[model samples]
Target: MKHSGSILIVDDNPDILIAARLLLKQHYQRVKTTDNPFDIAGIINEQRNSDQPIDVILLDMNFSQDSISGKEGFYWLKKIIEQDANIVVLLMTAYGDIQLAVDAIKAGASDFIAKPWQNEQLLGAVAAAFSHAKDKQQVGKLTRQKQGLNQALNTPNFKFLGQSNAMQQVFSTIEKAAQTDANILITGESGTGKELTAHAIHQASMRHNQTFMSLDMGAVAQNLFESELFGHKKGAFTDAKADRIGKFELAQGGSLFLDELGNLPLEHQAKLLAALQNRQVTPIGGSKTIDIDIRLICATNDNLEQAVAEGRFRQDLLYRINTVEIRLPALREHSDDIPLLADYYLNHFAQKYKRNLTITTHDMASLCHYSWPGNVRELAHAIERAVILSEGENLDVSSVVGNITSNANSTNNPIENNNAYDTFDLDILEQRTVRAALTHYQGNVSHAAKALGLTRGAMYRRLEKYGL
Candidate 1:
């Protein structure tokens, strides 16, 4: 996280390499330059063995001298990923070769900065990439602590299932963003698979082999948030019996997912922004700042923009963390996928509960009509609950709570019916209703406002009111 850290600049052109080194020298204490892509592996190995692995690599994906569709760059990138997947690799490309940049990302490059890049963009990417690497290392440490030193190392390929459009979109975004150091902000209502999205992003990223750390900002106490995120030195405070690495330091070269970010206090947000901003963490009661590299992903049930407007969250911080924003649709929006989700959860819990039951038409009708207030998470829990309590071969709706029905009149679209709110939270129900309108019109605020029977200003006020 230190601005004075080391960077290795690799480019085929002496001019470009020199320029890169000079550009980095402003922030980095030691900037190593190498114009030969062929020598990259040797240089990286030597650095790794010396325990001073280059903190960042400014690499040109195409070498003019040894061009065969970037064979040279590809070889080095593969080798680097194989040697140490935790390295922060920022790929450089010429202006008209964006397709090649995308290919490099798929091949494991951490990020891509084009030729003729702005100084601020390059430095910002470097800083963010380095922080991502440090965070992965920190998460690895936590995984080691939670299980064993070899736990993450021994894990096999991950399994995440969902063919829903939202899930597919989520997967594609993660695939594209994982190779880069871009910060991700996932927004969704409670139970809409935000954590799962975070997990998928990490699993598909270059740091897939490392640890994945997650914590809910809303659940942690304000006083404990600091020590929890940034480790404390031994005897730093009461009950600080031994040294501990916080999540930021523990998730180095991996990912740290902050769930319910809207719940994070302003103080915690400041510290997080600083760690992200400076790429360095000052642990509680520790004078020395630890350099860290981390990929950050934050999820929230509350609307962050409103939080920023209300002065509860930092606007600059939001810009920093939300390079890519993914909004997850609630269960009702994608009701067509309910049967699939329900079947999946049913099979999952049925296996766990040792039940050989199947859902019936009546049960499916009940589920489809029930306006799932809890989204996927709630549905999964309901299925598991039903699985455990079922007494027959066919699962029914009686095991689950809440109203689910069979009549078309009973299943009237909440957006078109006022009666749907009879048994639901008016605030959330209204928000969902308005959000549906916004979606139906592709975010045309005025049209959505008209469809929802409100003025445009009223609609905006509601969004601001609910932080939607």
Candidate 2:
């Protein structure tokens, strides 16, 4: 793909402008030439407003005949940098003024080319300067992406939860797919490590040095889909106060992971599909289409094929994103890995809270045997609570899921009876479990709610329902 950059040449001689334009117009994405030095600032400002600022400049030292002192070039060079300090300026000097060109370099000029230049020399110099300019742009882009990633992840480091056979198969598929730019679709239940799996593929891929941008499709509002994913020009909408770079543009030359892809509204699916099909996207209220080179990775718990059959999703979009599909195994599917995952989280929580805890063989057995409806995430939270509540060095996760407290023999604890729930009454069991969670957490609603895999609002509704 051509680098997303523009170049400008300022030389008083019409012939110089014509020659530079003929050569550079083919190489750069956008090249502008003029015989007036005074137009520099206005052009720069215009380009800035368009969100496609001039990247490099070729300025002639002498606007008049027999004047190669380079005073004019130096004056314009300062003005150009004042407009944008990061801009690269290459000086155009007469053959006899090579020493003057050296002086120009010291005065903030990137490199100098003698008038009546060789084609190779001009192209090479411009290519080098443009590369340096792109590096500068990349640094600024990476800074923005860094801040975004920090806000999104919240946690310091992200790690896989286990080394089970199912996970090994995932790693193997990642190793193969990392070598290609094919679009990937990840299907898995919530907390099944879909994001981390996509991240692992990107880290092992060739574009690892570039940004790994992501968007949660479920969170984006229906009305803001276009502006959020395809960017927008300033004032495109009432809330678009400034020019915005969307997920597609931000993930240029890298990977874009669209989380909860199934939640995307049916009407907006076509827009996303079009961008992926054309490999380019136009911002809202912008006429020019920007070329994209993103390796798309999408994840969702929803069954997209079923959605498509039901007319809730576009089948064409599904085919576009799923060149390769990876379905993460649920915790129940790989129950043997529970011990490793549990131990890892136990040690992690122990260090985090400055608590020493050891899990018994019986506790480990319970962890492996139970059905983890919330997958690995539930296990981590459970371990954290165990570490916090354990008074002894030996860890007791006996109350991890089935109960809330270690008072297994308390006469008031109805569920602890050997014949508890003999009739398999779900309502009675749920009530006992809710009461136990509240009691264990000392009526801490939030903690109890999270322990039961319920949102605080849902917990409140249940509390009112059961009159607790």
Candidate 3:
């Protein structure tokens, strides 16, 4: 396998340099040789500035005749580390001794190798050094990211926002689950605060002090899936100009939240399964597999069981991610909390917009009575808009409820389902028709799909999409 690793060979003998370069180039993507050790810094600096930093250096211990002490190798090793602490330096010499090897290691050299090294031994040593270099680079990044994340956690925006019986059960589950290392799967409709729940779990876990990295599976493109989850070396792709850590590594000793998990393609699902099972990831264009430690949490609105039955999602991957599944009740199911949720958003938006606003007693019913098809998220947006238009007056119920009704994309309103079927909102109408067909067939998905002129897969997708 071709490795996306850069190796620099420094030696006074051109023959040693030539042999090393020829062997290394076959395995490594970039291999450069120089007979002069003085040019080491210049070459390293140039490459680092160009975003292709050298990962490993093969340095000869004796550049001058009768130089058996290996002092020159130690000097260069120290200098190389000073320039880039992540670079792994391997010292080689024809004068082999245990004391010299120990000194080389103490001086920060990765390994001490004798000249005329076996091909297998040389390859094994370089590969190990390259992997060590990558790990060092990633650890540096992880430190910065951890600091940033700690600062962010001090002022979080997502909140657990309900006290209804259904929600109280969810809260109780979270309380118990948060104390364990079990992989969690959170299932809910759009805008139902799935991510917020995941965040809550992270905060309550023992790993709360570390990072909580979130990756939106739906938003990530297919080509960049591996890089996003498993990192990439510089020059791995056109846009990869520098070594980059992935969500898994950044979330070391913490949690990784994979949002919209159902949207991940089947092929990528297999790749993810492999990584999850192995507890390691081989980065794109890099042969070395990095061990990962993260508490996995996946959230999705789609019914994964349906997808799995239809062969759209992998069953084994499902078993890996959902050690414990938490299904959040929809907003309509917990209508008792609507007024509380509405008041919270109203006060929040009013404070944010610097407005003196309150929901009128008469108008509060509209918020409680209507089905929040878009759930809490859509409610927050509606309240924010109403606050903007309140003009320091009472919030207009029309401004909030009217906006939700006019949004034909709101498919979960049972009240609207009873309408004259006269509206031109095709999305709503399609959802209604699908539900009607299911009801008529007593939930026979095949018959419902046949009546709607949809394939079974298409029917399953719609059911999952509409959360039927």
**Could you say which candidate leads in TM-score?**
2
Native-to-model Cα distance after best TM-score fit, residue 189 in candidate 2, in Å: 1.7
Provide the overall lDDT of each model, using Cα atoms, as 2-decimal numbers: 0.76, 0.81, 0.83
Off by over 4 Å in 2: 1-109, 113-156, 403-468
- Structural similarity to truth (TM-score) of each candidate: 0.57, 0.61, 0.59
| Candidate 3 C-alpha error for residue 128, in Å | 31
Where model 3 places Cα greater than 4 Å from the true spot, the runs are 1-148, 151-155, 403-468
What lDDT tens digits, residue by residue, belong to model 3 across residues 236-350? 9999999888888988888999998887899999999998989999877788988999999999877789989999899999999999999988788898998888888888888
TM-score of 1: 0.57
In terms of lDDT, model 1 sits at 0.76
Relative to the unseen true structure, what is the C-alpha lDDT of residue 257 in candidate 3, on a scale of 0 to 100? 93
lDDT by residue for model 1 (1-468), tens: 337566888887788887777777878777888888777778878877877777778887677654546656677778777877777788776743767778878988878787788989988999998898888778867766755532453342223556778677777877888888789999876667888888877777777766688888766878888888998888988989988889998898778899878778888788889899999998888999989888899988677788789998999999999999888888788787888888888888888888998999877877787665556766776777778878889876565443333443444545335456654668658766875665565444545677888875697677554333
Q: What RMSD value applies to candidate 2?
A: 13.8
In order of lDDT, best first, we have 3, 2, 1
